[model samples]
Target chain A: MAKQKEEKLHKIRKVTPGSVINYTLITLIALICLYPFLNVVAYSFSGYNAVLSNKVTFFPIDFTVSAYKEILGKASIWLSMRTTIIVTLVGTALSLTLTTVAAYVLSRPNLPGKRIMSTFMLFTMYVTGGMIPTFLVVKGVGLYDSLASLFLPVAVSVYNFIVMRTFIMGLPFDLEEAAKIDGASEMQILIKIIIPLSLPIIATIGLFYAVNYWNDYFNALIYIITPEKFTLQLRLRNLLFAGELNSAGANAEGIGTQVMTQSLKMATVVVSTVPILLVYPWLQKYFVKGVMAGSVKG
Target chain B: MKQTDDKNKAALRRTTWKQIRKCKWLYIMMIPVLAYFVVFRYAPIGGIVIAFKNYNVFKGIWASPWCGFATFQKIFANKNFWNAVRNTLTLNLLNLAVSFPITIIISLMLNEVLHLRFKKVTQSILYLPHFISWVVVAGIATNLFTQQGGTINNILNAMGHDSVPFLSDNGWWIFTYIICNVWKEVGWGTIIYLAALTGVDETLYEAAYLDGATKFQRLIYITLPSIKPVIVTMLILSISSMMSIGLDAPLLLGNSKVQDVSNVISTYTYQLGIQQAQYSESTAIGLFQSAINIIILLAADRIAKAMGEHGII
Candidate 1:
C-alpha cells in the first residue's frame, strides 16, 4: 500500500495525456464553481458606475467600500444580521444539546426499548409531516409570527441525530462498561467522559446546525411575519427581489425610493455567504466524514 | 401449574422494571427528544387529515367538518395543479439527467488527477456551493445571468451579440436552472463516489497497465466498473425523490414569466397553503404528492433488488 501510494505521488510528475486532460477538466470545474464568488466580491466592492455599466466581471472596477458601507449602515440590514446570529447561536446550542443527549441514549445498545425509540426517530426521516400541516401545528402552538418559530420547531434533525449516534456507537463500548463498574451513572458517563471525547462529532454536527440556521430563509418566510425579525437570508431576498430600498441612512438622498445599487445587492450576498466561505476549507473534511458515516451505513 | 406460570410472569415484569430503573436517567434525557418527535414530527401527520375537512382557521382542525374527498377533488380538478405536477417531474428528471452523469464523470476525472493537492483544492471549491443559501445563489445567478447587466450577458453584448434571456424564457430557464443545480451539487455528489473509488483494487490497475491497456481503456474497464454499485444506488435514490423538489430553488430562481416551467409541487403548495390561505386544498395536494412519492420509492427499491443489489431503502 505504501509503495503504491508513493508511486501515485510520483505519477503526478509523469503527466500522461490522460492526466493532462484530467487536470485541465478539474481546474475548469473548479474555476466555474469559484468564479461566481469572485464575481460577487467584484460586484460588491466595485464603484456604483462600474456596476451599473457592467464593467465588473471577476475583479472589482474602481474598487470601493461604499456598497458594504451602504448595506452595513442600514438599520434593516443590521437587525436582520442580529436575528441571523441569534438564530444560528441559539439553534446550534439547542440542536447540539438535544442531539447529544438523544445520541447517547440511543447509542446504548443494552438499553431497553432501544429498537422502538430508534425506529420512531428513523421513521421521521423517510416520511415527514408535509409543509402546510406542520405550519398549522406551529401556528396552533402559538409560535406563529414569533422569533421562536424560526428555530424551535426545527430543534433537532433526525439525520444529524443518527450521525451523532453512529459516531458515539463507534467508540469503544468497554469504556462505558468500565465507567459503570466504577459506579459512574449513565448521565455521569455522558457528562464527564463522553462529551469530552466526542468533541469532534459535536463540532461537526454543531456546524451543520449553524449553517442550516444561518441560511434558513424558507422557515423565516413561512413563519416570521414581522419585518424586524426577518433572518439574514430572508432580508437579503427582499432587498434583491422586492426592489424596496431602505428607510434609513443607506438611502439618505431618496428615502423609500427604489434606487437599488447592484453593488449593494451583491454585497448582501457576500455578507450572508462570507462566513460559510471562511470556514469552508476547515469544514470540508468534517462534513465529508459526517456524510460518509451517515450515508454508507444507511 | 397456574401459580408457577403467574410467578414466571411476575419475574419477567420485575426484570423489565429493574432494567428500566437502571437506565432511568437515560429515560429522563429522552423526554424532550420524545416530546419533540411527538409534537413536531407526528402531530403534523395527524394534522394531514385536515386535507379531507373543510378546514377553517378560526374553527380549528377539531371543529372543522369532514368534506370526504372534496378537497382532493378540488386540487385534482385544478389545471394549475396538474401543471405544477408536470413541471416538478420535468425539472427533477432534467436535473437528474444532467447532473447524475456529470457527477460520475467528474468523480472519475477527479480520481485520475495525479496531483493530490490540486484534486483536494478542486473538491473544496466544488463543495462551497452546497453550503451557500439558495437566496444567495439566486442573487448571484441574477447578477450573472440577467440580460441587461448580468456579467455573462454583458460579455456577449461586448462581443456584439444579443444577450440571452437565461432566466426569463421558459426553455432557457430550465436549462439555466439545471446548470445552477449542477453547479451547486455536482461537487458534493462526488464525495460518496470518491470514497467508493479509494476502495478499488490497485492490482487491477497494475495488471491492466502491464497488459499495455491505454489509460482511457483502463478507466472504462477497471475504474468505471468498480464504482457501479454506488452509481446505481445514488441513481435510484435520486429517482425515488422525483416528486419532491425543494421549495427554495424554484421559488427563488423563478420569475413571473417562467412560472409555467418553474411552479413545482412544493412551490405550488406554498402558494395555495401559505400565500392564498387555501389550507385544506394545499394539504390535499401535499398528501397526493407524498402518496406518489412512496409508490415511486417502492418501485425504485424493487428495481434495485431485482437487479441483484440490496434495495436502496
Candidate 2:
C-alpha cells in the first residue's frame, strides 16, 4: 500500500508545468473542435420547439428520436445509402487495381519508355481541359447519366499513382532479382513477394480512395440526372436545399417533414463520415507514415 | 569485344521489338486513365474554341460558326465580371494573409505539445470539421446566425442588442465566407506544416534552451527556418489555386442581397455554361481563368526554383 501510494505520487510529480500547459491548450482546442459537432447532435435530438427557442446548446433540453424515426422510415434514404455503398466499394476496387498496376509497371527500372509515360501522366495533373470539354467528352463517350461515369472518369488518381510508385521504388530490388534468378515470372513475383510487403501502402491508398469516392457528390451532381441514381450526398443535398424553401413556420405536415429532414441530414452526415472515421484509427499510423514518406521522397 | 558489342546491339533491337509486341497489354491497362483524361481533361480544350464561335446545340462543336471573339467581348463588357474578379482576388489575398499564418502557428503549437495522447486527440478533433461538407457547415452557420431563433440572436437579445442580418448583408458576405472556409479547412491546411514540423531537429530546440532562449524565440529562430521549404512549397501551391475559390460555400452561404459580393469566376462560369447553356461565353471565361491559373503556377514555380526551393518541375 505504501509503495503503491509512492508510485502514484511519483507519477503526479512527473507532470511538469509545461506539460500541464500543453494538456490545457490541447484540451481547449479539442473542446472547440468537438463543441460544434455536439451542438449539432444536441439540436438534432432536442424537441423542435426547444431547438427553435435556442434552449439546446451542448446538450438536449427536451430529447426526442422522432426526427430519426421519420428519416429512417423513408425508403428513399435507404436506397440512396445503398447506392453510396455500391459506388464507394466499386470505385475503390477499380482505383486500387489501376493505381497499383500502373505504379508497379512504372516502378520497374527495366520498363521501356518509363520516363516518357510518367511525364505524360504528370502533365495531366496541371493542364486539365476544363469542365465543358470534359462534359462534352462524357456525352461523346455515351457515359452521361450512367453509374460508370462516376467510377471510370476518376479511375486512377495521378497523385496516388506517384505516391505508390515512389513507395514501390523504395522497396529493395534484391527480392525481385532473386525471384528472377529462380525463374519466377514477373506476375508470379508481384503476386507472391511484392504484394505482401506493399500491403501497408496499398491499404493506406485504398482507404484514401474509398473516402474520396464516398465523400464525392460532384460527379453525381454533374453526371447523374435521374433521381433514382442519386448518391447519399446528392440526396442529402436535395433534402437540405428542400429545407430552405420550407423554412417558414411549419404547417401540420411540415413539422414532421422538417424534423425528419433535419434528423436525416445529421444522420446522413454521421453515416457517410462514421465508416471512414472508424477505419482511420486502424490505418492512421500507416497513413501518416506513408504520406510523410511519399511527400519527402517526391 | 567487337563480337560482344555487336551481340548487345542485336539484343537491344530484339528487346525493343518484343516490347512493341507486348504494348497491347500495357495500352489496355492505360485505357481507363487515358480515357479519363481524354474525356474529362483533353476534351475540355476543344470546348475553349466555343469562345470564338457562336455556339449552337444543333450546329454542334465543329459546325458552330466563328463570331470572332464576340463572347470575349461580352465577357469583358460586363461590369459584373470585373466585380467578380475584384472580389475573387481580394478574398483570396485576405485568405492567404490571415489563414496561412494561422495554420502555420497552429501546426507549430500542435507539434510543440509533448503529450502524445493530447496531441492525437486535438488533431483528431480538429480534422473532424474538415470532413463535414461545406453545405452542412453552411446550414450550421445559418442556424447559429439567424435573426429569429438562432443562438447568436438569442444571446444578443438577452444582452439588449438588436440582431444583425449576417447572411443577407453584402458587407458581411466576404467575412462570413472567409470565417466558414477557415473553420472548415484550417485543420487540413495545417497538415503539411505539421508534417514539415516533424522533420525539425530536436537538438536545435535543446540548443536554444541552453542559450536561455524562450519558447517564442526558439520558434522564431529555430522552428521557422526548419520548415521554410515546406512554407514556400505550400505558398506557391496556394497561389496557383487562387482562382479556384470553391463554388459550394459561397453558393450555399450567399443570398440575393449578398450575391454581388459573393459571385466568383467559377460560379459565374457554372451559371453561364450549365444554367443558361451559353456554352461559348462560359468556355471563354473558363479558358481565361485556366490561363491565369497556369500563368500563376508557372510564375510561382519559377520563383521557387530561383529561391533554391524544390518545385513541381
Candidate 3:
C-alpha cells in the first residue's frame, strides 16, 4: 500500500518543463494584478515631495498620514460617508428581504402560475425600458432626487433573485415535506427549516447586494440631486474627475489647493475602498461559490 | 376517451385553482415582489412609449402628444448617435478579441498547476480587481497612465523615451481603456471556465497519460473539448449583448478630450436625456438599441442551438 501510494504521488508530481513555465507565468501575472493596488496604497501614504518627484512606486519612500488627515478632517466627507452608509445598509436589507421572500415562494416547483411569475421576472433580464424611461418612472413615482431613488428603483435584482431561488430549489424537499406533515406553516417552515439550511447562499446573496449598493454611483448620480445626499462612490467620482478636493477640506483656499495633488486623490480612493477591501478576504470564499452557482444558468 | 380527456382537463384546472387558493400565504408573500416588478420593471417598459411622443415635463408622460416615430426619425439622423453606435461596437469587439481567449488560456494554465497553494493565491489576487469600483480603477489608472507624473511615464522617461498620451490621444485612450478593463475583469472571467474545467473527468487524462500524451497534447485532446459548451455559451451571450456597454467604465475612464470615441449608447442617453432634457430623442435611441439587442439575442440563441449547444434564451 505504501509503495502504491508513493507511485501515485510520483505520477501526480511529475516535473514537467511546461509546468515550470506555467508557474512562472502565473506568478508574474499575479504580481502584475497586485501592483496597481499596492501602488495606490504607497502613493496615499507617501509624502507630498516624494509623490511630486514620482518616487513612490510599490512602496512608500517617505511615509506620512497628512493626505488621509486632510481628506478625512472635512465635514463633507463625513456627511457623504454617512449618506453612503445609510443607503448601503438600507438598500441591502430591503433588497435581501424582497429577494428572499420572492425566491422562497418561487422556489416551490408546484406553485401555481410559477411559469408566468418567473417569466415576468426573467423578461426584465433581457430587455428594460432603458435609462431614460426608467428615469422617467423614478420621477413619475416621486422617488426622483431622493436617497430612496438610489436603491428603491432597483430594489430586487433579477439576477440575485434567480440565484437565490435556484439555491433554494436545489435543497432536499423531504425535510420541508415532513415539517408540513407536522402542521408547520409555510412561514414557519421557511423560518425554521429553510433559513438555517441556507446560510451559505444567504450570506453570498447578502454580500452581492451589499457590494452592489456600496459600489454603485450611477443611480446616485442620476437620481440624487442634492450635494448633501451624495454617496461615497459619487463623491469619489466628483473628487477624482472634477477635482472637488477643495470642497472636501475645511480650509480650502490655501491648503486645499496645495494638498489637492495626486497623492491626496489617491488617498481618497484608498479610503473609500478600505471598507470593501477589509471585508473581502472573509467574503471571498462565498463570492466564488455564488459565482459558480450563478454561472450554471439556463 | 375524448370525454374522459375533457373531464381530466376540467379537473386539472379546478385543482390548479384550488392549489393557488390553498397557497394564499405564498401569494401574499409575493405581493411586494410583484408590486416592485410592476412599478419598476413593467412600468419602465410601458414608459418606453414616450419614445413615440413629445414628452412634456408639466404635461407628464400620459398627456404627452403622440408623434408616431418622429422621435426615432430625429435620432436616426443624428451624427452623434451613429458615432456612439460605432464606438460601442468597436470597444466591445476589441474587448471580446483581447479578453476572451486570455481568460480561457489563464484558466487552462491554472488548471495545469500541481502546486495548489500557488494557484489559490494567484486566483485570489486576480479576483480582487473585479470587486473594486470603476471610480477607484479610473483613479488608479489616472495616477499610473497620466502623461505628467504618471509612474509608467516616469519609467519611460528614465529609459530616455518620450511619455505617451495614454488618456488623451484617441488611439492610446482606447488602448488604455482596454487595458484597465482586461486588468479588472480577466481574472473574474476565469471563474466560470475553471468551474467548467473541473467537470472534466480525471480518467481521461490518466488514460491519455498511459498513452504517453504530452501535457499540451492532453490539454488539446481532453481538456478543451470538455469545456467547449461553456465557451460557446459565453461567446453567444457576449455577442448578443454587444450593443450595450455599462455607463460606469466609459463615463469614469473618459474625459472631454476623448468624448468623440467615448460616447456610447448608455452615456449618450444620459447626456441627452438627463443633461440636455432631450427625453424623447434619447428614449428613441434606447428603444432602437433594444430592438437590435433582441434581434441579436434571438439570432445568437438560434445559432447556439444549431451548433448543438444549449441556447441561453
Candidate 4:
C-alpha cells in the first residue's frame, strides 16, 4: 500500500506545459479577485482627508488608524456587531439542523411521499408567495420584530437542501448496509456513519448559510423596527442613507462630502465584511469542491 | 403458509411504526426547519389575498373587505408601473447579452492556463468583487462618476474633455447598472462554467491536439460543446430570475434625479407597500411581477427542452 501511494505521488509530479499555464492563470485571477478587497482595506486605513483627496489608490498614501478607532468607539457599532454574530451563529445552527434532517429524509430512495414532498419543496423555490404575503405570514406566526424572526423564517434554503441531498445520495450504501447488518437502526447509521463522512459538505453549506445570514439586510430593513436589533448590514445602510457621520464625532463640515461619505462607506463595508472574509479562506477549498460536486450531480 | 403470511404483514406494520419511533431524533432535528418554512414560506403564501382586499391596519388581512381587481386596475393605470416593467426587461436583457459571453470567455481563459497556482490566484481575485455588497459597489461607482472632482471627471479634464453625468443620465443609467453588476457577479458566475469544463473528456482534447488543432479551435469544438449543457441550465435559471433585478442596487444607485430609469418592480413595490403603505396596490404589483417571472421561467424551460437540453421542470 505504501509503495502504491508513492507511485501515485510520483505520477502526479509529472508536470506538463498545460498544467503550468493553468497554475499561472489561476494565480493571476486570484490576485485580481483579491485586488478590490485590498483596495478597500487600504482606503479604510488611509487618513480620511487623504482618501478624500484621491491620494489613496492600490496602497494607502497617508495611513492612519483613526478611522478604525473612530468606528470602534461607537457603542452602536459594537451592538450591531454583537447582534449580527448572534444572528449568524443561531441562524446557521438552525438552518443546518433542519436542512440536514429534511434533506436526509427526502434523499431516502424509497421513502413514502418522496415525490410529493420533493415537488412541494421545488414549488416553493420557483413560485414564492412574494414579499407582502411572506411578511403577513411572519406576522401571523407571531415572529414579527423578534430575533426568532431573523432565524426561523429562513431556516431551510432549498438550494442548500438540494446540494445536501445530492451529497448524501452520493454516499456509499455499503456503509449503511454494514450498519444494518450490525443490527444498527437507520437513525444510528446516519448519525454514526453518514454524518462523519459528510462533514465537508455540511461545513460548506453551513458557511454559505452563515454568510447569507451575515449579509442579510433586507429582512432587518423590513422586519426590524428597534435600532437595538439592527444587523451590521442594516446599520451600514442606515449610515449611508441617513448620512449621520456628524453623530459619530467626525467633523462633517471639515471633511469634503465625497471623501467622508466614501471613506466612511468603505469603513462600513470593511467592518461588515471582515469577519466572513476571515472565515472564508479556511473553508474555501471545501467550498469550491462542494460547489463542483453539487453541480455535477445536478 | 397462511400463518406465516399473517406474521409477515404484522411484522411490516410493526417495522413501519418502529422506524418512525426510531427516527424521533431526526423528527426533532427537522422541527426548526419545518417551523421556519411554515411561518416564512407557507404563511407568506397565505398573505397573497391582501392584494384583493382593502387591507386596513385595524381590520387586518382576514377582516378586510375584498375589493376584487381594483389594485390590479390601479397598477395597470399607473404610468410608473409600465416604465418599471420596461426598464426591468431592458436591463435584464442587456445584462444577459453582455455578461453571459464575458463570463464564458473569462472561464475559457482561466481553463486554458496550465499553471494551477496562477489560475487559482486569478480566480480568487476575480471572485473578490462578488463578496462586496452592491451598496459599496454603488458607492464606488458614484465616487468615480460624480460630476465634480470625481475620478472620471479628473481623467476627462486631463484630456480637455467634458465629463458626462453617468449616474443621473437616463440613457447611461442602465449601462452603468449593467456594468457594475457584471463586474461584481461575472467572476462568481464563471464557477458553474468551470465545473462543467472539468467534465470534458481528456481524450477529446488529446485527439484535437494530435490533429494539430490550435488552442482556439480546440476550445470552439471541445470546450464549448462540453459546457453547453451548463450554459443552457444557467440560462434557464437566469431567465427564471429575469424579473427580479434585485432591489438593493437600483434602490441605492437611484435618486429622484434618475428614478425613471432606475426604478424596478421590486423597488416600486417597496415604495408602495412599505414606504407609502399602499398595501393592496403594491401586493397587486408584486403578484404581477411574480406572474411574469413564472411565465418567463416556464417559457425558458420549454425552449431548453425544445433545444434537447435537460431543464429545471
In candidate 3, how many Å is residue B174 off?
0.4
Q: How high is the lDDT of residue A8 in model 4? A: 44
Candidate 1 structure quality by residue, lDDT tens digits, B193-290: 98899889998987786687977898899988888888888888899889999998898788776778988999889988888898899888888888
Instruction: Give the C-alpha interface root-mean-square deviation per candidate.
Output: 5.2, 4.9, 4.8, 5.5
Q: Per-residue lDDT tens digits of candidate 3, residues B157-207? A: 999999998887789989999999999999999999999998999878877
- Name the fnat for model 2: 0.38
**lDDT, candidate 1, A71-183, per-residue tens:** 88999888989899998898889889999999999988668999999999888877776999999999989999888888888999998998888888888878888898999
Candidate 2 chain A: 10-residue stretch with minimal lDDT: A245-254
Chain A accuracy as TM-score for every candidate? 0.89, 0.86, 0.91, 0.83
Which one wins by lDDT: 1 or 2? 1
Cα lDDT tens digits, model 4, B22-78, are 666655655666666666787677788888988897898889999998888888999
Q: Which stretches of candidate 3 lie over 4 Å from their true place?
A: A1-8, A243-259, B1-10
* For candidate 4, the TM-score of chain A alone relative to the native chain A: 0.83
- The alpha-carbon deviation from the true structure for residue A101 of candidate 2, after best TM-score superposition, in angstroms, is 1.5
Off by over 4 Å in 1: A1-13, A243-258, B1-10
DockQ of each: 0.49, 0.34, 0.53, 0.33
List residue ranges in candidate 2 displaced over 4 A. Answer: A1-22, A243-268, B1-15, B18-28
Please tell me which model should have the higher DockQ, number 1 or number 2: 1
**C-alpha root-mean-square deviation, each candidate:** 3.8, 5.0, 3.4, 5.2
TM-score of candidate 1 chain B vs. the reference: 0.95
Q: What are the lDDT scores of the predictions, listed in order?
A: 0.86, 0.75, 0.87, 0.77
The weakest ten consecutive residues by lDDT in model 2 chain B span: B20-29
lDDT by residue (tens digit), candidate 2, B167-211:
667776677678777778888677778888877887677667657
